[model samples]
Target: MTDRDRRNLLERRQRAAAEFVAWSDHHAQEQRHHEVLLAQLETHPDQLDGRNAMAQQRAWAQRDQHRRHLHDSALAQLRHAFR
Candidate 1:
């Protein structure tokens, strides 16, 4: 292959590697967030009652939505890396 082609291939490989790292980091952070939430619920079981439960549900739903968005972005990045 020509020098230019080799350089392009190297660049693409670098991009894919970077994307993999980014996705791994995002996944780790998401796991941490879940761990923290679980700890909170465990420590304060009373907060899961009645009105508080509804509020917690809404908050969790919002958080889950944001997390899903981030997860999708990560997936897209990884897909681009392979392409």
Candidate 2:
């Protein structure tokens, strides 16, 4: 790729990395809030995707996985750009 194109890719990835960091921080806060809420509703857990804790945990796991996917995709693209 041309120098300008590489520079642009670098800039875009930098912004994406920064945004990812912010999203992670925000997600952590939201996770904590949900944890608290779950604790408060120990008897029910509010039917998140199901009627039990396992279902809710699975759903949350998927959400976390998606965040990881975003990070991984950015890293892979950055690696490809340098090649």
Candidate 3:
């Protein structure tokens, strides 16, 4: 590739890397939030009964799934940018 084309590609890769870092930060925050919620549930099981407990569990699962998806997407983006 020409010098200009190489420079543009490098710029795009840098932008994608920055975006991946941001996504990773958000993903970490989500994981931390999930951990805190789980800790709360463990500490105060009585506070969340029947439907509330089930709902909270489901919410945690969904959050975890979303975090995983974000991680996967970010990895894919990085791979694509490098390619």
Candidate 4:
């Protein structure tokens, strides 16, 4: 590759890396939020108003699945950066 092409590729990779870091941080926050919600639902059932335990659990599961999808997408982006 030409020097200019190489430079552009490197810049793109750097940008992708930075973006992956930010995405990972956001994923971590989501995980923490999920954990907090799960704990509250499990530990303080009475405080959840009329929400049923099964419904609360299902909601958390759905959020967790979405987080996993985000994580997979972030990892794919990071992998593409190396290519």
Candidate 5:
């Protein structure tokens, strides 16, 4: 590969890696927050706030899945380019 092509591939890989890490971090944070909310829902004595947490959990899960798909696709593309 030409130097320019190699450099572009490297840059794309780095960007993809960085984006994956960021999305992962956000997902983790969101999961943790959901856990805390769920825990509170279980532990608290307030019957009024007995809202279902599954909806939020499912939303975050879907978001994470989408992010993972994008990250995987990017890495796969980079790998193909490098080969």
Candidate 6:
């Protein structure tokens, strides 16, 4: 490859790496949030009334689903870039 082509490839790789890192950080944060939510549920079970508790549970489930999807997408992108 020519120098320019190599440089462009490097830039693309760098951008991909940065994106993966950012996604990973966000995923970690989400996981931490999930843990905190679980802890809160454990410690203050009475704090949420029946409907609110159900709502909180649903929201946590959605967050977990989204976190998993984002994690998988980021992994796929990183793998593609490496390959």
TM-score, every prediction: 0.68, 0.51, 0.86, 0.79, 0.57, 0.79
Q: What C-alpha lDDT do the candidate models reach, one value each?
A: 0.76, 0.68, 0.86, 0.84, 0.67, 0.85
lDDT winner: 3
Q: Which residue pairs show backbone clashes in model 4?
A: none
Arranged by TM-score with the best first, the candidates are 3, 6, 4, 1, 5, 2
Best by TM-score: 3
Lowest-sum lDDT 10-residue window in model 4: 45-54
| Model 6 lDDT per residue over 1-83, tens place | 99998888898799898998899789889989999989877676587477777777898999999998998888888788766
Off by over 4 Å in 2: 43-83
User: Residue-wise lDDT of candidate 2 within 6-71, one digit each (tens)?
Assistant: 899788778767766766686687678668656755666365635557765666677667767766
lDDT of 3: 0.86
Candidate 6 segments exceeding 4 Å error: 45-48
Which portions of model 3 miss their true places by more than 4 Å? 45-48
User: What pairs collide in candidate 2?
Assistant: none
Tell me which residue pairs clash in candidate 3: none
| Superposition TM-score, candidate 5 onto the true structure | 0.57
- lDDT winner, 2 or 5: 2
Error of 6 at 32 (Å): 2.0
- Per-residue C-alpha lDDT of model 5 across residues 1-83, encoded as one tens digit per residue: 89998898788778767766775787687678667866765676655543545555566577668757766775676566456
Off by over 4 Å in 1: 45-48
Candidate 4 RMSD to the real structure:
2.5
Q: How large is the C-alpha RMSD of every model relative to the true structure?
A: 2.4, 5.5, 1.7, 2.5, 4.2, 2.1
Model 6 residue 21 distance off true place after TM-score fit, in angstroms: 1.6
